[model samples]
Target: MLQGEEASFFVLCDGKTALPLGTAQDHKRVGEGDTGPNTGGMGAYSPAPVLSEAVQERAMERIVRPTLREMSRRGMPFQGVLYAGLMIENGEPRLIEYNVRFGDPEAQVLMMRLGGQVLDLIQAAAEGRLDEVSVAWADDHALTVVLAARGYPGRVETGVPIRGTEGLPRSSVQMLFHAGTALQDGTLVAAGGRVLNATARGTTLQEARDRAYALVDAIDAPGLFCRRDIGWRALGPVQDAPATSQPT
Candidate 1:
């Protein structure tokens, strides 16, 4: 949806099957899966694991790089971040949609993976020196689970009491980012569609998945539901990966 060079966007479509797929999954609804109406994204995760480094490189060379070249040739001079949402069906990668800003859950996952270099990356992007900025990824995996309120998107029941979350392991592997929270009488309550993002990183995807599910259990909220198989499909059958708890 480029409008007179006002915004930047890119789409990656599968040459075989024309299905919309993106590297990130946005929690459009307050509920799990793709149910309910859209909201401001409850949470997101990235590096998707599905879009491997090789795939991204191919997309950059074939789709993104060429698109940027075309824009420059047209005098549009595209700049800023361009999100290329992709879908893969029948073992083929395809385009989904485009966005000017970072995808929510995808941003969170990427941030977790990037760790302390986020500010540096942003600065490089601003200065148009993105080519000079190389992304160094940790040999680990991350998973983010969104905590939402009951009847969210339609009718959010705010001011609901939120408990359990103290003593969460604050390591390079585990973090809890607040999404929709507020302080009322010195008590934290659910204030929006998604309230919290319980994220965990580990040496492997299954390890990260286990830690995330453990955090979900510690959180005593009954209104939240997350996909337990978030990274399972990407991780494939890892003999060393730990087992995750029951799905939330």
Candidate 2:
């Protein structure tokens, strides 16, 4: 079988300019090591190493920019976030799909890295001021592990109470984003397939992975579980960490 890793690239557009924000990669399957059935996204990390600076430039030049030019040429100039899902092999990028909105788990990690500046970037892109603004990226990494209902990407138990969210770390380096949650009888409960995102940022990928997993272990959602090896592709395999979906 052909081998490659997928990378998610974000471009801010305003029908006049397209600006590349950065790259991220996400795990799509419901199980560990990228096995099992495909889901929206199980986890994600930003600043994918496989998409090096040189590779990103090539992708922009050969793929994204040309597509934008074509859209403009066809009198359908696009605005808003253009998320490109690209498969990288031998440092070359191949388009998998294009999403006009921010990706799910991918956006989770990217936002963890981008912080409040993302709002400014979006506003600038919407106002056609992309040329005047620039993304200020930190020299760090972010990873997010998605907590889904026990039987995700298929049938899932709904209305399952989710606890310990308030207890999870929330700071400049750690965060918890509720994706498929609802308030019922004054209780936070799982209302969809993917429920929560335990995200963290650190100086290195390993640190981010460790911190994210730390939140996963502390969540008291009996019906939710997450992959333990979220950054395995970038960080390589490890002997530690719990099994995927080990009951909380």
Q: Please state every model's RMSD to the true fold in angstroms.
A: 8.0, 1.8
Candidate 2 lDDT by residue in tens digits, 19-85? 9988898888777677788999989999999999998898889998999999999999998999998
lDDT of each: 0.59, 0.88
Worst 10 residues of 1 by lDDT: 12-21
Residue ranges of candidate 2 with Cα displaced over 4 Å: 240-248
**Top model number, TM-score:** 2
- RMSD of model 2 against the true structure: 1.8
Which one is best on lDDT? 2
Where is model 1 more than 4 Å wrong at Cα? 1-46, 223-225, 235-248
Error of 2 at 182 (Å): 1.9
- Error at 187, model 1, angstroms: 0.9
Per-model TM-score on C-alpha atoms = 0.75, 0.94
